[model samples]
Target chain A: MRTHSAIAEPGAIRWTLTAFAVAFLALFVALPVASVFLQAFEHGPGAYLAALTDPEALSAIRLTLVAAALSVPLNTVFGVTAAWLIAKYDFAGRGVLLTLIDLPFAVSPVIAGLIFVLLFGAHGLLGPLLSRHEVRVIFAVPGIVLATTFVTFPFVVREVLPILESQGSDQEEAAVTLGASGLTVFFRVTLPRIKWGLLYGVILCNARAMGEFGAVSVVSGHIRGETNTMPLHVEILYNEYNFVGAFAVASLLALLALATLLAKRLLGDGSHGGQGQPGASQEAR
Target chain B: MSVTVRNLTKRFTASAGSPRAPAVADASFEAPDGAITTLLGPSGSGKTTVLRAIAGLEQPDSGTILLDGVDCTAIPARRRGVGFVFQGYALFAHMSVRDNIAFGLQVRKMPRKEIAERVDELLSLVQLEGLGARYPKQLSGGQQQRVAFARALATRPRVLLLDEPFGALDAQVRVELRSWLQRLHAQTHVTTLLVTHDQEEALELSQHVVLMRAGRIEQVGTPHDLYDHPSTPFVASFIGGATVLRGRVEGTRAAIGPLSVAAPDGALEGAGLQAFVRPHDVRIARATDQSAVSLGKIEKLVRVGGFVKVELRLPSGEAMTVQMAKTELDALGVAEGDRVLVDLLAAKVFVEDYSI
Candidate 1:
């Protein structure tokens, strides 16, 4: 029904609160984002296009894409597996395991990078073993990918776990009793039910993987056009007082964030309906 | 195919840290080939768990499950040719009715052409022919349950396990599905095991009922047998409208507060014995019948569904209920607060002592 609450705020107070929120958004969000674009084109579109096409900028873009391509799919698998395990089955230490899945979220990203360094750096614990095995993880592309994955590890699990928990294993069990094998049941039943949430999680994880600077910087060894990811490259240009170049690259990252927000808003409708009453989507139609 | 469970015991490690209590303890039952047998019990009585154990959804700590005389306890659920209709229906939300029905067949690697044919057959079988392209969420609750039924039966599994099949439907829909299921059962005659807490459902739909109490099988017999002869106090109260009474057993006769009936077999002389009398069995006896009758004050009277119910209190304050036709109530001239001579036509007294 009639869903609005009986209680009502005074008109003056409601308008004041609405205006206050709009002002806050304008000050904190709209201003900086607009300024980034304005600054990027200060020397006109010609210089803006040149900065974007710079060899180093192009290399940074490729490196960011490569890292995301490597880390995102791997993290997706890990995320789905973790969420499925936590949601469907119970075992000893399950609470501990669930808490540990959010280890990335709770730990500082810098600390995440340092932990990898300690384990894989030249003078660290397993460094000698890795070097002897002809592995260069701490200051290489692999290291950069690992650190990015570490920072964004929890996004998919966080999104997918609640959906799995709410959806329950009923359909999966129904599939099993219908003589569908476990893997078949997962692909045919479980995956489709959580498809929207899984997509949302992947988008979030990819956005973070591309924009993460603290962790990737520690592991990238600051190699220009080599290991520098987009965020690291943006930092280098800003530090060198190349305002137009820095803002151009920063504008790209900002656009990516904006796209993520739009996609989230779109998928958010489906995700909420997925967890709603069964006839929700039909009623929406 | 026939289904048999032997000495099944499954203990859930309690979430509150107590891990030793078995949810289904030593439950054993047999569903004869091509018949509907129901496991009837209250919530937490473990009837559904026993059904799940049979479907290979839950592994019993100690049990042997036999399907058509073949031990299949060690088999996984996907390999066990038993289809289970979940309590929540669990229809695939993403797939259309056709694809949902075709899922099992496709998973079994049936040819594409045969799957389409089978899907069409099942859609019509469930009377959902034209709705093949509709998603589960697009269907009504009854239609969704029917789709679930069709999906489960698509592969023609040897045994079918239905966990509270109508538990999710509202009153009118439940009544309709009950008969629909009966007709389906008659047509297919697949060996079925239904688990439900509703006594009327179990009594009406199943040929045999296994009554459970506190994770133990209390009695197993035909519905008529459970109603006519209950072996325990739990069965007497659980099966139908049997009002249990506190009484004492002397020789072969049990004496309730204001009435007496023949004690159930082996009910030796004892106090605190319970006598079970159905509402219809206790009626207004003739005034001059010379029966040892005690007067009871009608405490409450209400008309319910083709019959009049009179809840009475004896001199000793023991309460009893008797239901009779409205004509009978009128002919006897009994109303609320009227004192009348009550007689027990049928009473079951268990020999094994149990608190009322």
Candidate 2:
């Protein structure tokens, strides 16, 4: 509420609060982001290019992209299936299923990494069986992917669940009565309704998959190129006092953050204008 | 399609383990081809459940759903070829009105050109000629409902099931759609099963009404049949404006205070009886009138549109609602607390005191 008295008016306080927020963001967020870019180009574009093109740096980038590539799609599929079942149906263990889906969010990323280690490490629960089959998981690229996937597993389901739960099953039932097959109903009606929230979840899941550190660090043996992802690669460069190389790779991650922000803006205004907002309450699909 | 259900019991799951859930018990009725049969009852009476069972959306625990004399209980909803308009319309929000109507046809892989012609025809038929490009949210509630109607009919299913389709609309809109639905039914002549708690909608829209109460099928008959000759007290009270009274009927001198009715046939002499009287059938007169049957005191007088509603408290302590013209009321010269006589012009009497 706006105060009537001039002595206690918001006119002065609004600007003061806005200035303080801007100053805080600039110092903590914008400054650090700018410094990373500035240091990446500290020795000019040639050095920045050299650092990025270094064989080990190139492999680290490849491994990070591959991990994200494998994990994001896998989680997106799992997330949609999970959200569909959890939101659309009622069963004895539905509450348990929802809580289990949120386990990734509740458990620390390091613990999530440890869970995979306990399952598939050399001395893990399945250690002997995995060795007998001549398969590797922990201390390998697969381990890094698994840890990344676990950390990012809940994003899509958490996002899509609320929208589906609110939208209700009326449309689906109507489609069924209209002679639409199960797959047809999902593709034509259900998917279009939930696509926006699903897309938002995918974006968040992909971002986390690309930038995960603690979980990937626990499982990744930091094999310089095979297992080390971008964050692990950055830590290695920093430990060796290779500031330029570290910041250069770190700038890539910062670039990803900027890209994600851009996507949010674009989707928020553009799709919400043309199509609609994600939520069922907004009547936007 | 002439849809029939035999020995039908409400069951949501096909798994044979638990005893039948007491939702709709032994609700067997036939919805004739080319006619609208309404399952009319209050909410929780399982009217919607019965309609869903017919649509194959719900599995009946111990019954056979016959569509055109073929057992369709095992068939899925899509294969059974039923069209359902949900209470909330359930139009695909993301799709344009055109796409919404075209969805059913497209699902069955109809030719593109034929689908276009069908959509155009439906748009015109539902009286929304140029609103096809608009999404469901952009359309008004009535328009969205019509779109759901047209979409349901687009495939020309064997039977159409409507579950309280006009429930979400305002009273005026519902009345408008009520007549509109009759016109559509007249034109299409589709076999339809409508589920609604609104007795007026059911009576006005359906040729047949299966009145249900507490998940039990009360009676099945035509609208006038159910209204004029309700088989049970529940039916009598549910079908129309009936004020039920408990009275005693003796040899020709019915002992219902404040009103007198000719002892209904077979009402046991000198025994308690349940009587249902319509509001318009009760006539109020001055206490000194010769034909006055019993004494009553006017408890309240309310001026409704085109009529004055008089609430009369009988000597039996039962209140009787009667509607009369203002002129008649003025002639009687009765107000609140005034003693008057009541003559029950018509009533349906039962031998058993069901009101008890």
What candidate 1 gets wrong by more than 4 Å, as runs, is A1-11, A266-285, B16-18, B265-267, B270-272, B285-293, B352-356
As for candidate 2, its clashing pairs are none
DockQ of 2: 0.53
- Sequence-dependent TM-score of model 1: 0.94
In model 2, how large is the Cα lDDT of residue A178? 87
DockQ of each: 0.57, 0.53
Residue B336, model 1, lDDT:
77
Over A41-141, each residue of candidate 2 has an lDDT whose tens digit, in order, gives 99998999999999999999999899999999999899999999988777778888888888989999999999999999999999899999999999998
Q: What tens-digit string does per-residue lDDT give for candidate 2 at B1-356?
A: 79998888875543334655578888788889899999999899988888888888888878889999999899999888888999999888877899989999998899999999999999999999999888787888999999999999999988989999999999999999999999999999999999999999988998898999988889999999998999988888877788889878877756566456788666667788778999998876788764455788888999987799889888788888988898888888878998887788888887775444
